[model samples]
Target: MASSDTKDISYEDLKALLGKSENLFLVDVRSKEEVDKGQIQGSVHIPVDTVEAAFAMAPEQFKAKYGVTKPLLEAPELVFHCQMGKRGAAATTKACELGYVNARNYTGGYKEWSEKGGK
Candidate 1:
């Protein structure tokens, strides 16, 4: 996670990265209510409803308030997804602004990902 801009990645690329134990960070930007149905395995939860608030709150405060930890700088890639991909793209942009070099949005998002049965 560096100060490089966030980019969008293809489903194939995401699948390839997920295949390895590489430090790719998958962030699910969907809401908790949304996730109550289902979510991507191994993905971190940071509901879109609280993303801005979580970032605004300092690490300690954020954790105390919402139980979220700060970013792990060692991860070279960060992938964000939402129900339909709009919020995911916006979140990715914000993550890039916050210094995550490899932030990416899965445009196909949860709907498509799930429909593909995890591909």
Candidate 2:
């Protein structure tokens, strides 16, 4: 069984963090087609298949490609989400393996965000 110790942030917690943290990076790992329909506002779309490569890029390159500052390895609010949860969790784990020890998964994901009236 997978560890229940994986770091996850809930919708309410994420909302609070969003209001307070200018450093937060909300990364959406869903497909482009799924993302074209709707997404949590302010999320950076980085498809799940490209997550590792994206994370490996230099800071300047990442910013050029994604149009946001590259989050440092220790960034406190580096959060990932998908249409649902699985991909986000996987991305979080991948980030942790890459030294992003503070990485987090928004396990509630975009579905819950939309359902909860997140904009």
Candidate 3:
């Protein structure tokens, strides 16, 4: 991870990003248990603990592990979220340190997403 002050994006910004780009990755860093309840439709699961490992894997291995194609070393934009902002923020920092310069945290996370009827 780079620093505690990694960038954060609002839910509105996230929605706009979703509309504007296909070169995006929405990573849900909550545990599998939490994700099993429900998740934003297109997001992928990569718990915080494994985020570093995910980026470290070989390209083929990474794809096999996370299912995205070209965002192995340098992602267009990788957005992370959990129940709230903290863990996602931490993971966002980690992603950036791992060379994903475009990584960002969904500050409101799933809680706000749910509150806003995003599901």
Candidate 3 residue spans exceeding 4 A from truth:
1-4, 70-72
Per-residue lDDT of candidate 1, residues 8-56 (tens digit): 7777777778899467778899988888889878777888666666555
- Candidate 3, lDDT over the whole model: 0.84
Question: Which ten residues in a row are the worst by lDDT in model 2?
Answer: 1-10
Q: All candidates' TM-scores?
A: 0.78, 0.94, 0.90
Comparing 1 and 2 by TM-score, which wins? 2
How much does candidate 1 score in TM-score? 0.78
lDDT for each candidate structure: 0.76, 0.90, 0.84
Which tens-of-lDDT digit does each residue in 3-82 have in candidate 2?
44569999998999889988889999999999998998889999988999999999999999999899999898999999
TM-score of 3: 0.90
**Clash totals for all candidate models:** 1, 0, 0
